[model samples]
Target: MSQISKVVLKDVDGNVLHPQTDAGIVSVNDAAGSPSNVQSEIQALREKQSEMANIDFFVNKGDVNSDADLPAQDYKNGWAYY
Candidate 1:
């Protein structure tokens, strides 16, 4: 099932046929209305995640944007782990 808040009718050249002046086209030329090959995408993402290290904690605390050396010898703007 699909849900639509609004519908637009465009001509072959992609001009809006009956555009409401107050309304606007905010999308990019090549943007997709929905995702394609969803199952394949999900499986690929899961496989990628499984290969990554599960670092669940970090000890360093400092301004990450600074060029100064971080607290730990290895903490180089490394995020608080997921």
Candidate 2:
């Protein structure tokens, strides 16, 4: 009988997606050159959650005929639906 052994993960471009490890440990590469272990990744996500909690989501609700009907107002970081 054959037994399963080591495994290696890769991206479509053939880049190693996971950090080298000898055990069951895992890591996260949130972005290019931003390699972090599972623990640090969790911490970073928690911090981001806290920061996001303070953000206010504004929705510019109104009725419009089409995209051109939208007023010439700054809709940055906000949503507008018609």
Candidate 3:
């Protein structure tokens, strides 16, 4: 079996995040945390966050057949169309 090189990662404050070993006894692999893996993770998170940012809970409930910009109707019953 091939041995993977392991190291402890630290934050900006020098606090240890990941260690060379998982439980101080069992071996832990950090190969999945390569730069390319990190970049892809960041990209996936950004895309998911972007989709989350577009969640207009109010405007999303409007009917597709209406001009959703009526000015003075109380929309408590349903969507007001212009």
lDDT of each: 0.47, 0.63, 0.50
Error in Å for residue 68 of model 2: 20
* Runs of candidate 1 exceeding 4 Å displacement: 1-36, 54-75, 78-82
Candidate 1, residue 55: how far the Cα is off, in Å: 7.9
- By lDDT, the best candidate is 2
**lDDT, candidate 1, at 23:** 18
lDDT by residue (tens digit), candidate 1, 18-72: 6642112333222244433433344445666877757544644645554755446
Runs in model 2 lying further than 4 Å from the true structure: 1-25, 59-82
Candidate number that wins on lDDT, 1 or 2: 2
Cα lDDT of model 2 by residue, 10-75, tens digit? 889999887564322465676465866555555666788999999767675777875447768777
lDDT of the structure predicted as candidate 3? 0.50
Give lDDT for model 2: 0.63
Q: Clashing pairs in model 2?
A: none
Q: How big is the positional error of residue 80 in model 1, measured in Å on the Cα after superposition? A: 13
lDDT score at residue 58, model 1, on the 0-100 scale: 66
Q: For residue 27, what is the lDDT in candidate 3? A: 33
Per-residue error (Å), model 3, residue 62: 9.6
